[model samples]
Target: MNTRGQFLSSRLVNDSLISLFVVSTFPPFRISFQLRMWDWFQQYCPWVLQGISMVYGMIVRIRRKAYQREWLRPKHLSRPVVSVGNITVGGTGKTPFVIWLAHQLHAKGQRVAILSRGYGRQDPSKNLMVSDGKGHVKEWRVSGDEPTMIAQHCPWALVAVGPDRFRLGQWVLEQTPCDCFILDDGYQHLSLYRDLDLLLFDATDVKGLCGVLPAGRLREPLDSAKGAAAFIFTRSETLSSIQPVQTCIEKVIGQSINPIVLKMVPKQVRHLVTGEVQPLTFFSQRSLLVVSGIGNPRSFCDILTGCGLEVGEEIRFPDHCAYGQDEANLILEKIGQSDQDIVVTTEKDAVKLREWFSKDDPVWFVTTDLEFLAGEEHILGLLDRAGVV
Candidate 1:
């Protein structure tokens, strides 16, 4: 089907399904008669809206040889390249894992650098570097949420953003005598050869995706998991039977690859307005207004409620969405009217808020990271094989 038809089809499906659920809950609404029209729309509009994206992928795949001919042939920099990426769209926990991995490598006295595309960055024209004015300062955009967070935490490490990963990698090698490189969110970037591919999978979306794009959320097929030296499962906190789930995923990974189970548990809940770090127990008595502009809002809300927070409201926005002053003011206004309600947000949104919102605003940013519990050995062993450690 054409692009227009495909989009209409997807919209029809979404609208019809939503209408059905809403009508079921509100039988007195009298919108049940419109169900026939919805069904008709769904039938006539049955097509795929992702046709262009799928076609683009196909063209790239077809021309893989042409692109590979002049791929970034970087001279072996001192440090090995460990890429953290996923086959699907979002919510893979790449940033936290990279931070965790960097901290681990830094502890071993190895100089590390991070390269990323800096998704959702407003300016994509030039190469930018983010650092804390130390030896690792390189040209990469510091404006990105992830890069800024990395720079803030790992001030000593170099982080750069560029469309051309190979050029950026070479530039890093020239500027800093780094021992290793960590590719952030670079699962499908095949132009620059990576020594190790680390793929992350969100357990919720793993069940029903085709191999190509447009049909499902995946950038590639489920078999794409095989490319990674290791597979890390994000949102592991949701799994009731964690051990059995890990076993099943490990079986899919086979003998050659290792399975890493990482969970993003609530370590602490900070008061958004006061910046005071409190134990998660503080959430039990709080009337929370949970706000997050992250890849997975459901997960964020779940974590808050799971920690015993009475989630009275949840405001979710697009991933890396830049909030205007007025939008934040509205939230502030709502909070002001509440009875000492705690306004909660994620670290990513926190960065944007700090940059955009007034300093005196009561909104608080709570940070969370992926915690690799049992499979640290497996991940470390893979890095060892790559000679990164």
Candidate 2:
């Protein structure tokens, strides 16, 4: 599909309430008449588009069946591979969770390696490894927003990207004696058998989604949650009322898997220019302009409002949106027309913005992390039992 076509199609598939169940979050884009569209689409054309998408989806399922039938056995590397991913598409805070897991493993003296697909990379290569900045050059493109963020944030661990993570895992094991290989966003990549699977679900958007692919956001049905070793409800804040939310999720999945609920809250806001970290409290006293182009922009806007920031205006864009010069100019022009003073964006957008846009250009980026709540220890215990640490 062309870029605009891709965006529109993606928006339709992702905008449904069921999309929330699959991905960890919702589509950040908001249509002008979203409610009316939802009412109409849900009432009429849901089956038509969903049926079309399911044709593409069924092809994928058959491909998965090929693997299951032993036609595509993934090679087993020397070390155990633990995959951190979600069944649905979009952000599940996989980067942050990987970072957190690596640190936890590192504290126990276990070496870890990460493998990714490196989506949106400029270079074209099937087998590639990220560089370690030493005299030695590692093979792949360190270009995707999430991979770059992972590389920079976790320098101690080795990071690589390839379409075939099973191959990448084998290569990394040959290069380094890593104890564990962490597969980033490889839940559906069935060639490799993972030691543990963490499926992240966004709490806010699950209400409207009721069915399977194309008709809703689910890459697979909600029943796929049963396949995961553990389910992580990411970005669930106090405002989300996670307990009842967790109960609802368990009910939907049908097995009552007793998955752990992890709550992630924005604890601090950073000045992109000075690199100063300030308490999140400062947002309460400010009139803010929230800017984000991610899978779930409404959640970020809700976060700001939840934190007591007077969210004057919110700008949303398609997921993985590459802000161009024209778009930047338009944003600056809009800002000039508005009386709202401060600007804030999520950390994921901040990385993309840094490439072309900057905080010095009168934009302030607010970076947040997935902070696990009391259930953090319970999860750690599970990992411990699994010998992950």
Candidate 3:
């Protein structure tokens, strides 16, 4: 119609296009900036973080006390639930340990079902059955990466995901025959009563055990660890490496407790597309373009280096990162720049990246296993005593 009207419409369209471009392109930079700012705040503004942590700690204490005093009652399923969790916000090799435990119970002829909150999943369903004792029923995005990986490893075990694990367990029991349940990341989940709670700690991160929430990595006070039936020190390089953490925990719990020590060793490398298994020695001394979106990228890299692989470049994304075409393109660019290096990632990341990368891509994932350095018999005996087996 009018010239002014046309001018205004063109301007509006241009502005909208520019806004969309910025919104789409700014996320990676925004996430990086936010993480840096958070780290800076944690370091330089201790008083502020300490104040927030104090408030958070009070809430945690109140909720725990309510559960203990029966102000809030925990619901239990017909089958016993064995919880595998860590106090810290990051990884302590829980997936591998859960897979190991599931295999152990499965070998004993127990029908195991894994219950998880399915953190970072996009699905809004109340309860999603990830696997039905045979294979995955839902994709990784719907079931979350960790649960998908667990289901992939433990095909015979049923995996269910939902916020309310008690309801999820009930749903599983109603549908299938499950002898017991394995609660993943259930240390803070107080609504469901667990027959055995195994608390995990990263032995390498002893300093992270100092405070709660914003002040440190701990989800609750060190004293809360006493509620666990047993403690497990994961990524244990040696007894000396774990002694500091054990001492700190024992002092807070006001007693000495036996801790199971586990070393997460790389067992094999598997091709993500072809399902071809390769030994660790297959890639020894070769250059790798390491890509990971996990809580413990340093640990994963260390395992790679320990196996004699040179990390040519590393692309670290935030934990449980939902990979898309942008990430796939970035990874390909990095790989292209590297000098004949193979691409490597963690199993958790591989679950999502498999859809992004092709079958012909030189992408491999490291599969790790829990090697119990100590207290193996103690854990097995605890499982037996709890009637899990």
Candidate 4:
């Protein structure tokens, strides 16, 4: 094929795969033949994935090399920029982690500003105010759920959303200058230079080779994290579970480094509107219908089960689903007919549901907190070195 022919053909394939991925994300239609074909490719046609991954890896390397070679100059500001990101595409509890980091920084008397691409917002391409110094979000849909959640949680910190961080940073500086900036989900955002890069990873088995794309969750190869100043492992149930992953990381980076282990601890289960709080075990006896539009629904289910909730049914939508009236009606119908007494969901989903459900709704969201499994001082030390304090 000619150059243009190959380019068009490749573009067509990329478009097709993206469409398939979209279809596969939703549970209702995910089990269709399209997904089945994808599964078949993964199981039997390994070389095809390998071929695609090689091309993908080349693209990743070339783009990174462009930035490294100064063919593309990364924007750098006077203020310290701390980035929290992951190699994988899906959420590794990054939003909650960002909020936690903000809380810690604010406790130390630093003016913090959070900048996100505002993924899944109605108009995320343009810069907008998620929080105006005080925790006040203009519109949940306008700013995206994660930024909105941060704004709701951290009243003192400022959160802004724009796809272009360079433009967003300038706009933020003009509006209100901050002492420090936290770039959320910014590992691949090479347009900006970060003083500190904290790469986050979900706990996985070390024995398995870190795979990419259709084969695995790795957005970039394991070698990519070698440049990170520190590695943070999230969702470790036990101290022992972290060792193997740590060993793997050390092996990849060619040195022994102490990585921070974080636990996503359930904080509380609060009513969607009534302002009533309950212990996680409050729903121990009450059969619950769990609903979530999150990246990791299984983890949410596991947390609920761990809390001793008698979870009966689960309805999962794609990550950052803007719950419409039809979805609301379905939830209501499920709540009415199911043996469950009430509905439970994640905070991200709760933000969307508030638009559909009223204050009297039986829906409750489980608020989670990220706590250090061992090295709380490491996070403090990183901040201390970054001049966050």
lDDT of each: 0.65, 0.65, 0.82, 0.77
lDDT of 4 by residue, 314-370 (tens): 766667777777677777876776687699999888888877878788899998888
Considering lDDT, where higher is better, how would the candidates rank from best to worst? 3, 4, 2, 1
* Candidate 2 lDDT, 1-389, residue by residue in tens: 11211122123434545333222112323332454565577688777767766785677667666766778876666677788887655455677788888788878888778888887666636656574423233422235666767766677778777778887787776776788878888778787887777777776656423545556566765655666777787767653455664666577667675546656666788775566787878767777766676666667766777777787765555566555555455456657768766778888767666545564666667766666654677767777777777
Q: Kindly report which residue stretches of model 1 are placed more than 4 angstroms away from their true locations once superposed.
A: 1-44, 50-78, 132-142, 207-212, 238-257, 272-274, 336-340, 355-360
Better of 1 and 2 by TM-score: 2
Task: Give all candidate RMSDs, comma-separated.
Answer: 8.0, 5.7, 8.8, 7.4
Clashing pairs in 4: none
Model 4 residue 150 CA deviation in Å: 0.5
**Per-residue lDDT of 188 in model 4:** 89
Q: Pick by lDDT: which candidate is best?
A: 3
Which of candidates 1 and 4 reaches a greater lDDT?
Answer: 4
Candidate 1 C-alpha error for residue 157, in Å: 0.5
Cα deviation of 126 in candidate 2 (Å)? Answer: 3.9
TM-score per model over all chains: 0.78, 0.81, 0.90, 0.88
For candidate 4, the lDDT comes to: 0.77
Q: What lDDT tens digits, residue by residue, belong to model 3 across residues 290-333?
A: 87777776788778887787776676666777888777777777
Q: What is the lDDT for 369 in model 4?
A: 81
Q: Comparing 1 and 3 by lDDT, which wins?
A: 3
Angstrom error of the Cα, residue 170, model 2: value is 2.1
Give the winner by TM-score: 2 or 3: 3
Residues 1-389 of candidate 1 have per-residue lDDT tens digits of 11111011111323113221222212323434455544554467434434654675566554443544655343344458889998766566788888899999999888888888776577865677767338454322235778877777788888888888878888777776788899998777777678888987765443424335443455654544656777787777644435454454456556444457778877775544456787777667877776666666666766777777777765544566555665476566657766646777887777677644554665666677676655788888888888888
